[model samples]
Every structure is written in structure tokens, then in C-alpha cells.
Target chain A: MADARRYCTLPSPFPMKRGGALHGARVAYETWGTLNAARDNAILVLTGLSPSAHMMSGAEDPSPGWWEGMAGPGKAIDTDRWFVICVNSLGSDKGSTCPASTNPATGEAYRLDFPELSLEDVANAAHVVVRELGIARLACLVGCSMGGMAALAYMLLHPDTVRAHVSVDTAPQAQPFAIAIRSLQREAIRLDPQWANGGYDIHGDGERYPDMGMSIARKLGVITYRSAMEWNGRFARIRLDAEQREEQPFGFEFQVESYLEGHARRFVRSFDPNSYLYLSRASDWFDIAEYGGGSVMEGLKRIRIERALVIGVSTDILFPLEQQEQIAAGLEAAGANVDFVALDSPQGHDAFLVDIENYSRAIGGFLAKL
Target chain B: MADARRYCTLPSPFPMKRGGALHGARVAYETWGTLNAARDNAILVLTGLSPSAHMMSGAEDPSPGWWEGMAGPGKAIDTDRWFVICVNSLGSDKGSTCPASTNPATGEAYRLDFPELSLEDVANAAHVVVRELGIARLACLVGCSMGGMAALAYMLLHPDTVRAHVSVDTAPQAQPFAIAIRSLQREAIRLDPQWANGGYDIHGDGERYPDMGMSIARKLGVITYRSAMEWNGRFARIRLDAEQREEQPFGFEFQVESYLEGHARRFVRSFDPNSYLYLSRASDWFDIAEYGGGSVMEGLKRIRIERALVIGVSTDILFPLEQQEQIAAGLEAAGANVDFVALDSPQGHDAFLVDIENYSRAIGGFLAKL
Candidate 1:
């Protein structure tokens, strides 16, 4: 399958936010449309923890992307009118210089040797990619989930660079509940003997992989990503057929268990555990309060975007609606024209990816106005 | 720590709900107050997943029990006037015939060889203890958390035995969300190498214990047992002091993480992993719909009780208030005088143990009327 992936070499000795630096690092990205002469129609897209830069398919890559339904020609993030660019986050495994990437210094996987990652570093890396594309000022910046935090960092670090912003189902800072969940997930991976202190085999070599740890971590992620309301409505107390269940003790008896098992199996083999650890820890450390006198709202107020659309899902337990409201309030407090829309989508934190109609309508309406 | 624990040997070849049976099985129990000549003041208490028969300190046991604040001389249940009996469920590790108990036939721990357990089996075991005490009828049967389901089963299987019931923070059947959480927990345990297919070392011998898996499971349990609202209100982005943190990657950073670690550390060594797996799976299999012929309300209606007090917490995500409402509605439909009290407790599903004052009032009020 063809992928419309492009790479931009980061400046050598690229300094990290929490100290240390990387040399000869590169970021992977993809663009959807032609950059106008003025470059004012350019829009930068940042993704959640797992998604790659391929937000939508193009002529170079006909295969459907992660957000294929929501970003394309005549879609919510219309490629027809906007020069759309999406970059993989710095510490992500999807074509980014992450813990899974081979170190230029030793030709070994960075793994635990990778510098402590922060959303600020992710933002700064994306800035390198954006500048390389000859875009002095972006017309808008779009970020969803973890990407939304990076977008906030982007605007904060480079004031006046982004004219508008769309923050989708993300938090200004993670709550204790989210921190606890992520901490447990990281523990699950680190505790696995096969993880070997983040030195587990990434290649399909004779060495073992931390499949069980990754499976448990992914299952925890899946459980938190969606809402209980959705789970009850979708699966209820439905049990799996005997044929579908493993004839073992404590095996899949319910459909929900089977669904989670399927999700874990699909995810464990594809994603790098070390990369997951770095990103998960980075998410926990992303407290906006550190930038603004120990206040999340004050930190958000530092961004200089002119107009912003802050969207939240009502059923999101991880990044609940209150966080989105805080984002909108903080931006509005900063003299930005902010439109806060809380969708009654039962898909929870992952609503932006699944409830395409509502999310598209909200995004399309906001973008059209800009 | 003197414990006010007693034992009752169950009838030989104790039949299980799913299939199979246990021979020479025994149930652990503790009682407070003297049984009246009429035997009409007996209150049978069914505990949650982990608690022992010791519910409160008494003449025989000086140590404070799990429900130390709610069931004593002048407390809610007021043992001075009522004969209170609390029993450890059959599949629990707490002084009961469980997966951790010795199989008389083999002279080894039952472990995976233990039969398929059900809430019905737990109810039946508790019934034997109550009958052994010579109580012809229970004035009130108080069941909390997982025990609440057993209480329902008790009312259904042995109609008219329990005159009044208090179902606290439990579901008629496991919802998909709850099932998913539990299944992930079981998977965590089973995947641990030390678990060795439910044969983990229970004794402090050379064989390794599934501590990591148990720790993960316990952390998940603590996360669901409490409310996010309470977490936000209590911990709210509070970082542990550098001195309190472990100098390791993905170690204790947030106060919530520290709290969970403390909980997991305290619990992992005490509980048997095989018993946990059996009880956790039993919780998933419990469906009132099974008894009601595909209807939860119908199954609840089959329970013959004169009165019931259904209590739930507003912040409970596991056994949400909606399930509490359903319980009340079902009992009322069955011609039982029902008093449904939904407390605005921030403690969530474990509110019955923590929000002592509110619970005391609700429980005490109902018992006083009885």
C-alpha cells in the first residue's frame, strides 16, 4: 500500500524541552493540497497519541487514512480549499523520531536512552516541519486529543504564528484519574519481564516481545477511550457464543471481553512498547500550570490565536467537558474569539474519530467562518 | 489481632450453580449480640469481594473490622439490640472454603480445580451458616457490592427466608463496562508467568507470586471503586514530593499514583490470585436475567421479600445509580415495600464503607423501622 509520507530532517542537536538533545532526527508528515502563493490557506493538523501523519488519503496514497472520513476533498477539513499538513508527534512510533527509532549516535534503538519527552518538544518539532514547508504563518491549526495539547504548546511557543485553532476532545491538563490510568498502563508494561527495562525486541528476532504487557495496556486504553453509556448500549450483557470463546478458565465469555481481546491482539504487535511508555509518561507530565504561575487557565491564556473552536464530548471521562470548557474560557480570557461546542456524543474521548457527522459539522462550521 | 470468626461446615457435596460440587466445604462467619429466644432479631450480613467475616469489633475480637464504624453498639446496625452475623463468601480467600482452601480429596489447595462458582453458590453457603445458627428467618439481610448480588440470589433461591433486604451499590447483572474491566483484570493475572495457569504460589515458598499481575488488578479495582469527582477534589494534580517518589522511570509521581501503589502493595500479598479470578468471573456471570427468563425485572420479581432498601451512590461508575433505581423498581414491582436511597456521596461504589454518616442514617433508619 502506498503511503503519502514525507520526511523533514530536524536541525542537528535538536534540544529537548526537559533537557538533552537529539542529532539527525527527522519528522514524518503528509500534505493534502497545494500551498497558496501567500501561504495563508495553510492548516497544520496534529493527531492523538496513536495516529500517524496520514490523516487523509491523497493522489500519492490512495489508501484510507485514520481520519479518512473527516478530512478529504469537500470534507470537514476540506483538502479542496486548504493546504492541509499533518505531522506525527515527536515521541510517537508512527514514522517519528521516537524511542523505537535507531539512534544516530550508537545505531541502536533509543529506548530508555531517549530524552524525557514533553508536549512542548512535540510542538517545537512540528514547527520545524511547518517552517520547512515555507509557511511563515498558518491560517489555522487543528489538533485532536493529545495533538490538541501540542497545538496549545505550538501557539504558546510561537505567538502569532497560528491565526486560528481547533481543539478537539483534549485536556488543558490531565486529571488525577487520567494520570492514575496512564501510570497503571506504564506499570503494566514496565513490570512485564519480557519488557527487559524497555529493551524488548522490536524486530521479529528470536528475542521475546512484551506482548502481554502491551495487550493489557492497550485494553486499558480501549476501556478508557469510550464511554460506559456506549458500552451498555452496544454490548449490554451480551455473552459470546461458545464457539467464539476460548475453552479455558476465565476466557472470553462476554462479547465485551471478546471485543477487548480483539483490540488488544491487533494493537500489541503493531505499536512499540517503549514508544508507548515515553508518550504515556509525556502525557502525564503535560501540566499547563508549569508555564503560568501554577494555573492551567493562565497557561492557556498565553496562546495568541485570534479565533478558536473548542469541542468536547459530553460522555468523555478522560478529557471530560469541563476541560474543554476551561480551554475555551482560557482562550476567551486571552481576548480570542472562542466558540465552545460540547457534543452529546456517547463515543466519549474517541468521539472525534467515530461520530464523524457531529464532529465534521462542528469543525466545518467553525472552519467556514474563518 | 483477635478475630471474632466462627465456622459452619456446609452439607457434603455442596452443589454449584453452573455445575460440579464441593465436598467437605466450610463457610467462615462471625456474630455479634445474643440470639433472642424468638430468633426474630437475626441480621445476616453478606460482605463485598475481599472482606473477612469480621465486620466490627466485638467482645471476642478487639480489632476493628472492615465496617467498624457502621455496625456496633450504638452504630447503624446497633448490635446491642440485633443479632448480627457476617459471613465470608465461599470463593473469597478470607477464612472460607475457597480456591485457596485445601481440597480434602487431594490434600492440596483447590485453586483451578475449584468448581465454577456463582453468586448463588455464595448465597447457598451463607444460608447454611444462617441455618446452622438456628435462625428460621432473617429480620434483615444486608449485602454490599458483590455481596448484593448474592443477596438477590438468596432472596430468589430461598424465598421467604429473608424478610427484609438491603442491597447496596450492586448491579442486577454485570454491565458490559464492568465486565470489560474485570476481564482485563483476569487477563492481567493469567498472563503473569508466575500465575502458571492459576497455580501461583500462595505460600511464601520459593515459587514466585503473581505480584505484578495482582498489583495491576488491584490498581484497576481501586480506580473503579472510587469516583473521579473525589479524585479530582482530593488529589487534583498534586505531585508527590521528590522524597516520596521512586527515582525510576514511570514511578510514583502523582499523588493518585502513589495512593494506588500503596493500595496495591497492601492488598497483593493478602489475597489469593486464583480465588480472585474465580470471584471476579463469578461477578461477570451473575445475571438476574438468567433467573427472570431474559428480564432483569422479572428475575428480581421472583425474589420474595417483604421489604427492601436499595442504596446507591451518585458518583458510582461501576454500579451506577441507574442500577439502584432498577433494583428499587424491581422490588417494588414484586410487591415489596422498597425504600430507595440514592446518596450524593463523592466516594462512589465504595461509599458504603467510607461515607459512614450518610450510610449510617440510611441503614439505621430502615433497621429502626423494621
Candidate 2:
């Protein structure tokens, strides 16, 4: 029972959908359990905006995964019966060929010259990783948020690669509201004087990264990821220091403020600002209808999956429940067996990550049917 | 018949509700129509976070007001019949005693040295101007957003200052969700290197203001001010340029991004960052319950208005409809004639500013009954 994180390089001159090519592109992935002799018991797990290939515990790296609750030996994903593979997204900085990666042509960091990335490219890169692993098909494909968009793109591009698909808390296309939020995030990073036009030394001297701008962007991201009801119920205007009610010019007083700042501070340390900008733009530019020559239903018709599951959180303002409903409707119209579940969770877009019990039940039940 | 914008300096040593005093403090105001011989037909209108005392077209400065649709002659507020007085909120940069004002003690700009401000202080400052004008009582007090909070404070503090009260798009207390948003806005300004700890020379040459930080904050403010449904309906993932689809490192390619950036750019030129910081904190610290033994009902019991109207928009995520309901319930419990109108508006908290027709009808009808 060996669980190891591994890396594999794709074929030389890997082309991107959005007019770019990587000479030496590599993908990082983690695997659990053993692939059956038929290689039909493999499951691929794709992640949201900020997750690595570590979906669960591994022998080499035993640190907990982002979705550790769902992918253990007898958990929702059931590693005891099925093999699971989690691949880091193509343009992400975490062990992937991203802005932080070295360019083969110049022998320097890609920085701002990493080439344009699209959701389709992330999907194709993951597909190549699966093929390189000698798996002709997967038992199921699970994705969340940006990963959800990538999964759908993969289903459309490589229709026969995956037998089942599960997309949670995502939209077929980026809505104006969601795009506007991401656009501001990019602006925050761009406007920072220290960013140096996205050419700053990310790991060098004084103020190497745009930490202030990225921190504010992450703070705004946290607000959008969670519902107001959840914040109200949890924080409720409680002061961080009840004893020190005297006003200060600039200070973190409210519990919600402290919560957001703490999260943002931690994120600024781990994420690359350039990679964040590229991946966020990829999500915004993703439109399934565009791939199908202008109809989402036609796009769904291209995905030849046996079964599909779409889950949405009721209070998710970022993706909204209506988007999931549309996804389910599109899959149903495509003649695929679709199971749609709407969870009434106040965690909003992050409900898929926060409410583990409910998500595990939904994912477990959906996988049980197969 | 003259509609004139005017200024009045309060007597020396003006005390604040909080422990601070302002010397040579003045309030800028605009008056529409002549006060009746009895002076009982005067209607005092209060503004939101970013508006001045120009409710309608004035003789000296004939620019249309922010609420020009509802405050014109024979309009909802009916300047032809009822004289209207629009006072600039204290601590606002729009011709009020704010961070930009000169300190009588040091003979320099107050900057961050400006004493802490609260909603009660704004209400009290406005009340002094009303009293200085020799008006014993106001026919009505109409407020929107932050102005609504001030109006509630005025009603509680002054009790019999106004005969009728109309609050729109505001809550009696600052909720944790709203506080978190404001806290982030303040943090954005503080983290900017150019801010110089709120001592930036806003009028100095060569990028004196913290434009980038303030712009991002304003952009975030704009998003929260409007509803997601409104943004989706207006600009749903439209490209700014069809030909420039090829990705650039830092570029504005979405229509929503253009809209937000344009708004942010304009806001940076007009708004002072220190003023924004102070006023935003004022809104966050505002809690009507704090004034009345930790009970909002107890606070509302002190307001002795003859009639009250609380208007809320259904899609207003910042100030939800339930807060307005609570306001109405408190007023009803206090034995006042309360009119609670909940509008199904996609404009969110900005419905009071954007959907003028609905607001006009509601406010006009409520005033007509009085």
C-alpha cells in the first residue's frame, strides 16, 4: 500500500489551446491504491483555485490533503476499492509548470511570459498526465470550482477518457458578477507598485512579492467565498478585543476582520501572484457553449459519460445554484444519467470544502450507484 | 423660490457625542424653496456614504443632485410645497469637518489625528445646523444608507426634532458582514505604501494620494453596493474588445472590468483616502443598541416621531431586508405609525439611488399621507 506523489513530463512542444506552447511541460500528481489489471478502476480528482495534487494522505508526503475527509481508505471516494489520482492544475504554482517554472528557451523563470492559459489547456494537460500513466480510461472524474470547469472541458475534449463525472459548485461559464470580482483581484495585484509589472523576484530581496495587493485580493476572495449569513451567524459584530473598546486609527477590531486578514496573510505567503492572475483569468474565459459552437447543451452532448453528478450550494453567490441547475439540465438533455443535488449550506461557494459531512454523503451516494 | 447652497459655521468649541470637540467646525448645506412662515414645513434630507448637500438643482451651483429624480420641485420630496434642507454629514470630505480639515489646535490638517466619529456625532452636528436655522421642528427626516443610520440616531437623540421619519437601505446596527467589508476597505488603504499612515498629501504634486489602494477599495465597495443579479443582467461576460482576445499579462478585456476600473479611477480623483477611512470606520462603529442599554427596542422607544417609513430592497445583500423589518417592528413597538415597504429590486443597496421611480413612489406616497 504505497501512496506517492510523482511528476511526469508531457511530450516535447506541448501546445496550448490559446496559442502557446511549452517545450518542457511537466505535471505533478499523487496516487492512492493500486490500479486494477484492467486499469478501469482509476478515478481522477481535480481541484479548485488553490489546491495541490495532494487530495489525501501519501506515504512520501503524509500531510493532509485539501479534501482529506473524502478520499481516505473507506471514505466517500473509497480508496479501499478504487484508485484515485489528483493532478495539480497546469498553470498553478504548486509543483506545476507555472510562472515560477524555468523557461527552457531562456533558462529563466517564465514570470509574465508563461503564455496564455485556458481551462481547456488545464484539462488537456491533465489528460496527457493520465495517458502517460498508462490509463486508457478513468472510472470517475471529480472536480470542484475551477477544477469543475476543467473537468467539463476534459469531458468535452476527451469524451471517452472518463466513465463518470462529478462537478460541484461551478458554472458552465463565468458570469459577469464573478468575472468582475476576479477582475478587481487582478487589478489589485497589478496596481501594487511593488509588483514591478509581474516581473518581481518572487523569492528574493526586500518585498519580493506583491504581498499587500495579494493580501487584499485574498481578503476580498474570502468574503465572496463565504455567505453573509454565515459571517453574521459566526462573528455577529463581536470585537476581537472586548476589553479594548477604545477606538484606534487603524486596527483589526472585529472578529470577521481578524478572520479575513489571517487567511489572507497565510495565502500571500504560499501563492504566486502571477500564477494567481493567470489561473483566475482562465476561469473567467471558460465558456462551455463556446466550445460547442454556441450551445451548452451541445457541449454536454459531446461528453460521453455514463453517469454525471452536479452539486450546488444554495447560498453560493459566486457560482449560484441556478448554474448547477443549468448543468444538470444540459446533461439530462444530452441523454446522460444525471444526479443533481442542491445543498442548503450557508458556507456559500466554499460549502463544498467546509460542509464535509454533507458533501461526503452526496459524493458517497453518487459513487455508490456505480 | 431660490434654491441655494450655503455654509454655516457652528459656534466655537462644538462638542461631539464621543469625547472630542471641534473648533471652527462648519456644515455645508443646500436649501430648496423658501421656508414657510411657520417654518414647520422644512424637510431635512440626509445622504449616504458619498453624497453632498445638493439634493436638487441649486441657484448658486445648479448641478443636479444625486437624488435629482426624487428631490426636484413637485417631485417625491415636493420642494414646491415643502422646503427641503440637505446637510452634508460631518466627517465627510464633501465640505464638512473631515480629515482634510484644519485642526484648530495645531493649525494643520487633521489627517489621522481627527478624533473618532460616530453616527450620533453626524446626527448631532446636523441637528445644530437645523437649530441654528431657527427651525423648531422638521416636517420629515429622510435618510438613505449611512444617512438612514444618522436619521435613526437623530430620532433617538433629539426625540421630537422631526414629525416624520423615512429610512431607506440601512440598518439600526452594523452587522458583522458589513463591518468585515468596511474593515477590508480600511486595510487596503492602510497597507498602501503611499498612504504614509493616513498622512498622505492628497493635493501635493506627483501621485500624492494612495490611488491604487483607494481604487481597489472603491471597486470592492461598488460590487457590494449593487446586486449580483443586476450585474448579470447588465454585463454578462461581454468582452471589452472582440479583436484583442489574445491574452496579455495585465490588461482590461472584460466589459465589467472596464466598468469597475472606470468607476474606480473617477472615485480616486474625487475621494480623499483619509476621509474614506474615517467615514467607513464611523459606519462600522455605529450600533443603535449601544445608546440604549444594549437593546435596539429600548433605543427606538426614545424616538417620538409621529410617523415612520422603513424601505428595504429584497436583493440588497449589504443591508438585508430583515434589518429594515426590525426597524419597522421597533418603531411599531414604540407606538409610532410605521410604514414598511419591501421592494423587489435587483439594484441591491443601491436601489435607493438607481431605481428612483420605485423610491419616489414610496417616499412620495408616505409624505402625502403626512
lDDT of residue B163 for candidate 2: 95
Candidate 2, superposed: residue stretches over 4 Å from native: A1-3, A204-206, A242-248, B1-3, B204-206, B242-248
Q: Is the docking of candidate 1 incorrect, acceptable, medium or high quality?
A: high
Give per-residue CA lDDT, model 2, range B279-308, as digits (tens): 898899888888669887777777788899
**Worst window of 10 by summed lDDT in candidate 1 chain A:** A198-207
- Candidate 1 docking DockQ: 0.87
Off by over 4 Å in 1: A204-206
10 residues in a row with least lDDT, candidate 2 chain B: B241-250
Give me the overall lDDT of model 2. 0.87
The sequence of per-residue lDDT tens digits that candidate 1 reaches over residues A184-205 is 9999999999988887787635
lDDT of 2 by residue, A1-370 (tens): 4446688797779898889799989988988988989988888988998899988886777888899888888999998888889999998888889988999999999988899899998999899989988999999999899999999999888978988889999999999889988988887888787788887777634566788878888988999999988987999878877664425567878888878878997898688888999999999999998967887767766778888999999899899998999889888887789999999988999998889999999999999889
Scoring each candidate complex against the real one, what DockQ results?
0.87, 0.77
